[model samples]
Target: MTDLLMNPTVARLTSRSLLGRKRTLLLSLLPLALLSLCTLARILGSLDDDIAGQLQGSLSADLLSTFGFAIMMPLLGLIAGTGSIGPEIDEGSIVYLLAKPLNRYTIVVTKLLVAIGVVTAFGALPVLAAGVILTGELGEIAVAFAIGAFAAGVGYAAVFLLLAVITRNAVVVGLIYALIWESLVGGLVPGAQTLSIQQWATAIIEKTLGYEAQLLFVESAVDFSTGLLALVGVTLVATAYAGRRLQTIRLHDES
Candidate 1:
């Protein structure tokens, strides 16, 4: 666990790179947008009951599911996970590190920690705050979405990190998974829904919230056990495979 959580130098480098200006801007926009929308939701919910009804209906379905889980986590996961190694590979710097006497497993785990750390920070906090504001309540739905977003972020970091290891087009692939597979197909196709991270996270939220939360539109297509199993299994498999793939990764000579 100690070895798995971090390595000082690697963590520092990943943190600096992941939180650089452009990426910082992207991350900042998300939380700001979520919070702003949440605040407006609260005001509107207070002004009139009808608009409040509309906002409440969309709160769980659109804001929590669509924005937080589908959009935020995967996008953050892709940027952090792939950006950890993608730029180094693109500029021919990865060869220097690849030739070093570091354990491949340690390197992979270190990057993963950095990725998951950033994802949790950016993904979970805003969702929790937004859920609370959107509903003007706590515990019932807010806490549930917070935990779901964090879990989904963790699982997403592992999967996208593996994609970074396997392909240069990892970002493009991740977007397709985030948008097309999870968003487009998962809604229309029953088989695809079973494998979706969003649904798994929703299952978590559904189970976490108290019974009174049924009034909210916190719909989930999968069982809690199945969702839990899928999220954990995918994270472990992706991380293990990424470590193995890292061993075989061929760094081109900069010359």
Candidate 2:
């Protein structure tokens, strides 16, 4: 189990490389923007009686859901996911790493763990903070979105990490999936929502919020069961495939 699950060496190296100066700045940017927007909204709501009521009602929910869940979480997942192993593969450093006496699955799982941790810290925490700042309390609205962000973060990390393993153009493909497919098409097309990590998160948020979700108008194209199943299935399948792909990777020097 230990051999298949994680390696401290891989985890340490992946963390140091993934969270390097430039990538750290990039990861911090979205969270900073989220907190800034929440702070600004809090200030604006304070200045207006009607807006304050709305913030307590739905505006806060919209901000947390739309920007935090729909935008920031996926973006963070992409950066953390690809950064975990993409550079190593690209620069042929993966050859050295692979030459070690380690299971390929162990490497994938360790990197995936690091990616999930990064997303939890930079993605889920910010969403939670933004929700509290916007709503002025750690209520259902705040907690629900935070949980949803974490769930979505996990799914995105796995999926994007698989992309990195399979393609050098992981960033381009991930951006199109995040920006165009998930954000754009998922918004307009009803069927696409069922296939989206965003909507799966919405289902999670709705489930977590429960009756309060209705009050806040939280709705998802898919039900909680479908969403939960899809999230788990994708994460497992992607991680497994990535491990298999890594096992078969043809190193430049080997060729």
Candidate 3:
């Protein structure tokens, strides 16, 4: 287990999968769009609080909630989470690792760490940079939103990793949850908003910025406590479940 945890080979594999051509391209898209929009917004006029408010409130909020959480987070999670283990499982290459003396749980934990790191870099960091670009450090709103993005990234990675362990269609299911449930239903249905990852994340931002801030840049359907609880609970449960699943996983024949 120690060797597996310390293994450079695992890190190499994780990095390769994460930085692969397709995943890298997809991951770059949203951040590029964000930067471009910020540049365009700046070019149009001087950065005013009113302009910042509209940018941060309407545009930034929409991008973070709709595109960041609903699209980018899940897509990045799907790539990082499933990319960490799915290909190995699909091609029966996992037997190489499983046959070693390492404990299965160690492998799972290592991969989960890699996935979390990847999600943080590709998902959360960009959100932070984008938030700053949109609103500056005004009232620390950018910092607040960044914290929410980081928290959401960790939770999203855990959930998607567990989904990878449970099903081959982890990406599809993740997309459905992120896009359909979080985006479509969570918007129109009042009850569904309480269950949304996007809302939970935004609630963190709302709390950090206060009620007046909530009235402006951030909006959340659920209260702060519920959102924090759900975020922490989902992250812990999904990680634990993924570890347990790894312990019992059976590798398929390559031939």
Candidate 4:
């Protein structure tokens, strides 16, 4: 029996599917846009620390938080997390793996690891590069948002991966959460911000960036400690639940 901890073949397959053809092009959108936006923002404006800090903070909170963390990371997470296993289950090909001696936990965990890695590479890394580009230095603001991006990636990947296991409409659900709740409601309602993944991630940014974060428009709704707990809790609960769901998964014979 192959180790349930990780199967090299599964990892390779996930990597190929995630990075394949149209998906690679899809993943490039955020990085390319971020780079272009930051490059233009930097060039069009003068370079003073005060000005740099203001611009960086504005981009970090207004632009990056709205687009990168709220929209991009979750969408990337939805695509990767759901893409990793959803297609197999839809094709009814997952039954072959389930029929084998592998632990369901192993399958869930391995696929989750791949999805998280994909988000980090495509989502978190680009945000970091964009941060550096906007600020023109590897300063605290750049580093703080990089950390926030990774945290947001972790939260998004776990939740979407669970959605993939539980529902066929994972993408639909993910879009509602990413777009409607985050973009529309969170902006209109104050309390909704407290429960948001984007807000939780900004809590980390608030704590880490210290004084520089004040230049930004919004403060994180939750405290730093609460954000950490919420992030960890969401990740653990989603991953555990997905593994449990995988154990009892019923395959339909659509042939």
What tens-digit string does per-residue lDDT give for candidate 1 at 1-255? 775556777778888988999998887787788788778767977898887886655554467777777777778778778877677766767677778777778788888889888887888888888887887776456788899998888888899889988887888998999888877787558888888888888889888865644666666789899999989999989989998988887666333
Q: Using lDDT as the measure, what is the rank order of every candidate, best first?
A: 2, 4, 1, 3
How well is each residue in 71-100 modelled by candidate 2, as lDDT tens digits? 898899999999999999989999889999
Candidate 2: regions farther than 4 A off = 253-255
**Model 4, span 87-115: residue lDDT tens:** 88877888888887877888888898898
- The C-alpha TM-scores of every prediction are 0.91, 0.97, 0.86, 0.91
Where model 3 places Cα greater than 4 Å from the true spot, the runs are 1-9, 47-53, 56-59, 253-255
Give the Cα error of residue 44 in candidate 3, in Å. Answer: 2.5
Reference-based lDDT, residue 67, model 2: 91
Candidate 4 global TM-score: 0.91
* lDDT for each candidate structure: 0.80, 0.91, 0.74, 0.81
- Candidate 4: which stretches are off by over 4 Å? 1-4, 46-53, 56-60, 253-255
Candidate 3: residue 35 lDDT (0-100): 63
For model 2 the TM-score comes to 0.97
lDDT of 3 by residue, 153-221 (tens): 777778888888877777888878767887688766899988877788878988887765645656788
**Pairs in clash, predicted candidate 1:** none
